[model samples]
Target: MVDFFTPDQIAMLSASTVRCDFLVKFEFASSTMRAWNGNTELVVAGDTYLPMFGFGQIDGLGMSGGTVSENVTLSLSGLPGQALDLLSVALDDTPEVDQQMLTIFLQLFTDEWQPAGTPIPIFRGFMQPPSVSRSAMQGTEGATQSISLTAENIFYSRSRPAYGRNTDRDQQARSPGDKFFGFVASLISKTITYPDY
Candidate 1:
């Protein structure tokens, strides 16, 4: 009979190293739907970290068999008006503007000997436009307004990340075609074309 746990599995479970830090980057959609060939790093002034963040596993569906989708929730504290303006451009009310998407990259690093060791990407995917909300509470001390961004992963695959437009070259290169762009384009086109024809 085969053993329940393998040597590699035991070693991995008993590993002492723990993840200590994380790095997150966001890429907002641009004017054109062609493809993203530019840098995706978000530029912020001074030091700023997402106060609250969570990604992966959609509740009860965690153990389900079908295609699994993930979600990301980010809370930004003391967000400046300038940053909000930039985000507004990406996530707006108009149909054309709302089509814009966000690419989020999250990297996790283990508590190893090296201070600058390479980080492993834990989650990376194109997220639907965030549902943003601003809340202000008045207290005895003062009032605070915080902004929260919640988005769902557009594609389900963990190994393959979905970003950029689907090109003819990309379609021909991969057997299954680009998962992210392919699925989205088909869904959107179907919605738009169904009523027209």
Candidate 2:
């Protein structure tokens, strides 16, 4: 009998590391989206913050069974809408912003870690700040809003993760590592509530 347990356990252990990397990537992408979306409030030093009144994290899981897949839908009715045509997320510099994004990603990874244990490092990957486009919207009441655009078939995937060794591992572990990745990815589905500034 091929121990599905053994491979699954090792995969979970190795995935702990990979999970951290995945979360980091998701966080970076989220921050870039918010910054480039142009709805964030710019602070005194030009740093932007998610608008306080409308900011919230959308937490959920996505799953695929064979060719069919499902993800939780989030409501973005509380967030401010976009204005800029194409926001540039400067990735050429390694500054506090980049470090903050990394730290945030790690925190998010741990927070979403399922079948929770000590957080472990599992994989490594990076993405270029993607090419951006924008879409404009108009309300019947004469309001204007914009959205950062996405194209069809723009698929991207990171290296698969292998998790850390599970010591005193429970045979009935109810959670899977893929859920962590799905949750992080769902952050990209942010919507705008107030579009016109």
Candidate 3:
């Protein structure tokens, strides 16, 4: 295996007191949204990462034998709007999860909370329909809402993700100008020649 972490990032990780954050990105219906575990806003790669105190933490993020586990579970509990809009979409499209993708990025930070380097994409997977739990306001505690879900890893047990199509339309959906699949439509109808040896 090759070392992919930068020296600065390595140094940050090896520091006596280290600060780090996990940046989470959710892509659905061709839209991208970002959030981070830190308590403050951050700008990385020209994209703003808002604090996701609601994203309390993630479980089962480690890798073994160079392969990710089949599934990881995470929960997000927050009152801030928009960061949790993915929840609404999940509820509305309960049966259409193949079109959505969830990615986790690792970003190392200095003692001052400044980013050490660009966030590195560490995990890619699909988030299952989450179970939402809401609490009614009573006494001093404010109303609370939280979502919990299992994320199936894209690289599980040496298998590819099941959400894929080889059609031209699928290619166009991801990249309109990409014509690699332009000939796929014709190949199926074209005759093939075989040499006799």
lDDT of each: 0.39, 0.29, 0.71
Better of 2 and 3 by TM-score: 3
Candidate 1 has a TM-score of 0.39
lDDT of 2 by residue, 51-90 (tens): 3233232323333221122222112222444232122343
Q: Give the residue spans of candidate 1 off by over 4 A.
A: 1-19, 30-66, 79-116, 154-197
- Predicted model with the maximum lDDT: 3
RMSD, model 2, all Cα superposed?
18.2
43, model 3: CA deviation in Å? 1.0
Error of 1 at 34 (Å): 22
Clashing pairs in 3: 54-77
Candidate 1 lDDT over 107-168, as tens digits, reads 23334422132232344445444454444556654444444444455454444444222543
Q: What is the TM-score of each candidate against the true structure?
A: 0.39, 0.22, 0.66
Ranking by lDDT: 3, 1, 2
In order of listing, the candidates' clash counts read: 0, 14, 1
Pick the TM-score winner: 3
Candidate 1 vs 3: which has more lDDT? 3
- Model 2: runs farther than 4 Å from truth? 1-49, 52-61, 65-140, 149-197
